[model samples]
Target chain A: MSVLTSSSEAEGEAIVLASLVEGTAPAADDLEALHRRLELAADRDRMLDLAYTTVDSPVGSLLLAATEKGLLRVAFAVEDHDRVLDVLAATVSGRILRAPRRLDRVAFELDEYFARGRRSFDVALDLSLSSGFRQVVQRHLPLIAYGHTETYKQVAEVVGNPRAVRAVGSACATNPLPIVVPCHRVLRTDGGLGGYIGGLEAKTALLALEGVGAR
Target chain B: MNTKKPFEKVVAEHGPTVLRVCRAVLGEHDADDAWSETFLAAMRAYPELPADANVQAWLVTIAHRKAIDVTRLRLRAAVPVGDVPERASTLGVPGALDHELQDALGGLPDKQRRAVALHYLGGLAYAEVAELLGGTADASRRAAADGMRALRLAYAIPERTGAGK
Candidate 1:
């Protein structure tokens, strides 16, 4: 491991390094405490640009991410939360941290929604991830309302693009915020569950949660 | 094509190593402050850091600056009597391994201590440590070796190789 040293010299440095490491490794508890404290300080100083956390729900573990502007994305465990965070890092800003405090309000709201104690989400959203037609389609999704279902064609019409029905389906399929955006309420014209970002079971589960009988 | 990862990943990957470096350089009492300051500064500048930048070295550089600031403050604020009572009495007992290690590291000359911390704890190569310390890589290796020898002698670290016998 010693790049510039002769074999004997390298072994000597390695032994010293090992002994120092063994002697001075911080306690696990101390490292954990320091990590927690650093995140909080980062948050308070507004140094953290994007904050994320995971919340367990009836669906599965939901990844909640937010910017200073609002909640940016909600991801399902199936989507691979790590990949989602990486995409967020590459696209948005790399100053993302797993700071749960920034996401506490959203987590609570999601918990309430899963428990059927709430209907609509009061949290602000950052829809910057989607743009143009897809963004238009997603913004209309929340208007489908709790406990109400709309066909993909109907959503296409509502967005003033009846010919863009396929695009509307694509938008719902790619909906970044998933459940909070209420994309599950958009069904096939014949009433079959066409597609969902969180998979068919999650779609059925969400529909059932919203008091909509699954077909 | 920004290939940089989230700052959280950087912190998670290198946090323990950085903390160890801080403790080795600043001692347990002042390490936390240096660590917090280092990462806070890192988070602020993360967006602007080049994607290919050696993130661990960047963090250590910030930490090195923070350590200097803390050391300056420590020197100005040093009072022989004030810190004696604050060290937990329990720490004085034998078998307190970290305290013993910290004392050993604290006793080193500045160049040796820094060389040991940066090369061994910060995971920087001798060349990188030299860049930060303004000297040749060979000189850094020598300083670190000297520091490590002293630490082993003070802390009673046994020689692992039978070649020494």
Candidate 2:
């Protein structure tokens, strides 16, 4: 959570945060029934117009964050129920509402992606962050495909600058799209795994899944 | 310029945790895609994350959705994941239990399942889960304990590597 210097802003944020974490929110039993799920993250009044999602994903229970603009955040290893809600309120000034229909649609699409090596998603994206070089990085990231590894130099080459290896790495390091762009597929010229923005292990795992060379 | 905010820092720091969660919930092959998707989803909107939000819980929610979504879709389109066992299936559980453990875990209500898996697999404290998930500490405890109880009842056969080994 950002350090709130303004007591009023802090107080308002706190109230919004408190409202988000007001109660006991749990996922529904039916894996497919995300819409019926109501999380006790906040009071009924607080989640008035927010997008509510409790997705049964590969990673434990995932709580998706979205607004009319599109998905805002995706949390993992959900702990500290109150803190989570507070963070959400702080992110978007408007009250956090739990509209299941809005989030469930994203959940359904994500389900398809995981059920296999999903090459595409039907969910509309906000893509607000991918601009300039970041957009360039995202555009080239996915072209690496599954199981193929390219050195930073190679990525630079693909980006049309064979000499800009380090720059390419930086672009990749800050890549907005990790999977759609397959950043894990990027590697060093040697067989060694390159540094991953997430971690080498995750990078290795992604490569392995695509049957990339694993030593 | 420390342009990246706390939520972004949270994503960078806890990327593995998110990936691990996805793997545990989704499966190996699909976990990476889900993990990437989770972050991609986060990037698009994390810039505007509420100042006081529980970053971890937000990520967990994403991981959970992406993992389940991809896994379910695979179940629909690919050969059923079924009961095929692999050497690593024991995961660090020491006990060589069958997929029944996962099946029982899968059977749990979402909150309970998350509590158990986070505490057990992810090695998170109940308090941590509570804060991220925005639940009372006691509530997190119950969900985790209840999940364990259900697994015990469902499996009945001791840890396949059975008893303190």
Candidate 3:
């Protein structure tokens, strides 16, 4: 059957409409400024209030997130930025926005650490994501010293559960905050590099950055 | 399965399109306010939104409501003003040809304007546009067609000799 309306006429209308849309589109900078203003409004409203930013590191981009309380999560690029954000949305608050100023201290500390100018992170941390034994394990992980290593069994004993070596490995494997918590410092009792949440290569690199050789 | 991503990704992906729709419906001066309000509302309600929900459609819907509110506010504010010549030159549409198109668009009836904007700029289907505008799909399609025809007539220019027509 023949169409009543001419196809070319409809096509011309579509082209004109498309051009009208293009000509009226707002500038990129305007949109960015609008986003910044919206972010400020959201922050002032104090709804859930999780802010995040990305930092470049020797390994790759790190997603750093924080709350009003303190720095919350630091994730590696391998974890996938989307997935990491989803996790943050689920565990912390879905009210997440990328406001880099909130993570300034974390980024600065990370930059210093990567450049070998800082030995330990000084930012406040929110450990609500970890609990009980895992929390205990993570709390002790940073005590491993900047340039030293600890066996899984030693970590287990340090947390007051010497026989729970496998549990210590699990804690390290599931550490909510990895590099900041220094989970990479825990190794197998046989002096071999153990599993790291950031991957074995990242763990080795971190150890190398700390002037320790992963055997 | 419903999937969710960071709100940043959502904004980065859809900000331009939403801004275009806002500018089309509200003009440049008020579009920024409408855009800001739409995203603020969306961000506030984002967590409760189903993961399977059409994010762009959802955003456009919020924008539609915000646009209506902005239009109402602008109309209310227009009341106390003295007679002043409208600043045609400062209209947000960039080039001369598109400026004519925009002027023609502004002259259309309200239903036709909303129908054309939802269908063309917001990229909604006839049925969706009808639903948003509280009309039948056939009615929405007719309004858009009528608006387009009017635009074509209004936007036409005389041919120039030895120059691109």
> In terms of lDDT, which candidate is strongest?
1
Candidate 3 per-residue C-alpha lDDT over A1-215 given as tens digits, one digit per residue, 9 for 90 to 100: 11323554655586668666876676767878988887788877775368988888998888888888887888888888778898777666677888887888888988999999999988899988888898899999988899999999988887899999998999899887778889999889898997988889999999999999756
As for DockQ, the candidate ahead, 1 or 2, is 1
Q: Candidate 1: lDDT of A73?
A: 97
- Interface RMSD (Å) of model 1? 5.3
Rank the candidate models, highest DockQ first.
Answer: 1, 3, 2
What DockQ number belongs to candidate 3?
A: 0.37
lDDT of 1 by residue, B1-165 (tens): 656888888988888788778777877767778888899889888888988899899999889888888877766676666554322222122332466676777678878988999988998999989998878999999998899878767866554444333
Candidates 2 and 3 compared: the better one by TM-score is 3
Pick out the ten consecutive residues of candidate 3 chain B with the lowest summed lDDT. Answer: B84-93
Q: Residue A212 lDDT in model 1?
A: 97
Best by TM-score: 1
Off by over 4 Å in 2: A1-63, A67-100, B1-165
Q: What would the TM-scores of all predictions be?
A: 0.89, 0.38, 0.86
Question: Candidate 2 chain A — worst ten consecutive residues by lDDT sum?
Answer: A23-32
Clashes of 2: 71
lDDT of 2 at A27: 22
